[model samples]
Target: MAKVLYIKANPKQASNTFLISDSFIKAYKEKNPADQITTLDLYREGIDFLRERDLGDMGDPEKLEDRNHRVFKYAYQFLEGDKYVIAAPFWNLSFPAILKAYIDYICISSLTFKYTEEGPVGLLAGRKAIYITTRGGNYSSEKTRALDQGEPYLKTILGFLGITDFTVLSADCLDVIGVDKDEILRAAIREAENLAQKF
Candidate 1:
């Protein structure tokens, strides 16, 4: 059975984004009851930001400290997962800073990826990732697509880690005026359920 690592990046309680993510997880569990699931809530965990000292110690094994060991442990957990699920809400055209910090911790050189003569190569190949996000505005349209940095950034980073096979499930237009919020959320939840079965 696959080991799924679920990362929750939303801090808001009773949020639509969190509710939708929960729906996806429930469906996934139903379909893959034997599979193991590990969850990491960035806000609740209060992950620290990556600092210069940490980066230096990361490369120097002799200088590793307790904090560096913690970071490496996080990276090890990332490598152990067969699949990843990141649930986040759009914030300032991207994701929360806590999520970014988590990304920094996991994307370690010579760990998640390495530089080759040709270029950088992802160590975790053949794994997949699923990104679940909610945005207030409709960024799918050409007029506003350029403003969407969250999904695209996520895709790029995951690709960098050799996780090219992935899916993005987004519930947009959440904050649009006159839009049917309940309808949009319900539709998104349905979509999440469907994806989970296949995931």
Candidate 2:
């Protein structure tokens, strides 16, 4: 059975992003009934930030399971999967701070990625990832290109971890006037279902 980790970054309890993610999860489960799915909420769940003590014991075998050991273990759990799906809204042209913080924990040396002579190679391989996002403005135009920092940064970070295959689906102009939010959301859910069929 395949294992999927769904990361939710929206802080609001009933935000649009959460709704979109839940719809995706539902569609995914309906298609792959035998798959295992895990949900991680970056804001409400709160990821442990690396402190000075956590960084001090990088390669020390004696302190493997010390105070900050759980962080690494949790990160391993985050990376130890066949696929990942991330849902977040466009915040200041990027993701929430907590999402980035959680990523920092998982991207540690000798854990999620490793340095090599050629370059830093990703430790996790053959895993696919999907990103779902909603934006407040119409970012599809070239004039609004600056509003798309979330996708590129996520692609870079996940690619660095060896999770190469990626798919991104986004709904833009949610907050724009004279636009039908319901239709856009319905379209996104339809796309999610299509992706799940092929996932």
Candidate 3:
């Protein structure tokens, strides 16, 4: 059975991003009944960002091997997951700062990635990731897709960790003027469910 880690960044149940994620989870569970699904609510978890104390741990050879250390806690958890689901809303052309903090916690050497003569090599190779998000503007087009830095930024980070199978399910133009919010969400929810079956 695969270990699925669902990372939720938004707190609102009615959020378009969360709704799509919920649909995907429901579908995924139905399709893969034996899979172990764990939900990490970032808002509720209250994960801390890197600080002075963490700085020293990152460089310590002892802490790298000691998984019990606080510095390796989140990174260890992240590495253990076989599949990942991240849900967040677009804010300031990116996701929430808490999500970035969570990434900071996991982007550790020997856990997520390591340096090599060739360059940094990611450890979480062959893992799969699904990102669910919503944007106010239409950022799906070739002309505007570059404006949405959240998806690409996340894909890049996860790729650095050896996850090449990255999928993004975004509900775009939800809050656009004269756009039908309900219709936009419904389509996204449908797409999310479809992807979960094959994900």
lDDT of each: 0.89, 0.83, 0.92
Instruction: Give candidate 2 misplaced runs (Cα > 4 Å).
Output: 62-68
Whichever of 2 and 3 has more lDDT, that candidate is 3
TM-score of model 3 vs. true structure: 0.96
How far is each candidate from the true structure, as Cα RMSD in Å?
Answer: 1.8, 1.9, 1.2
Ten consecutive residues with minimal summed lDDT in candidate 3?
Answer: 10-19
Query: What order do you get sorting by TM-score, best first?
Result: 3, 1, 2
List, residue by residue over 1-199, the lDDT tens digit for candidate 3.
9999999998676788998999999999999999999999998988788899899889998878877778787888888899999999999999998999999989998679999999999999999999999999889999998888899999999999999999999888888889889998999999998999998
Question: Which candidate leads in TM-score?
Answer: 3
Candidates sorted by lDDT, best first: 3, 1, 2
lDDT of model 3 at position 89: 97
Candidate 1 — worst ten consecutive residues by lDDT sum?
61-70
lDDT of 1 by residue, 37-126 (tens): 999998898899988877877887654334348668788889899999999999999988889899988898788999999999999899
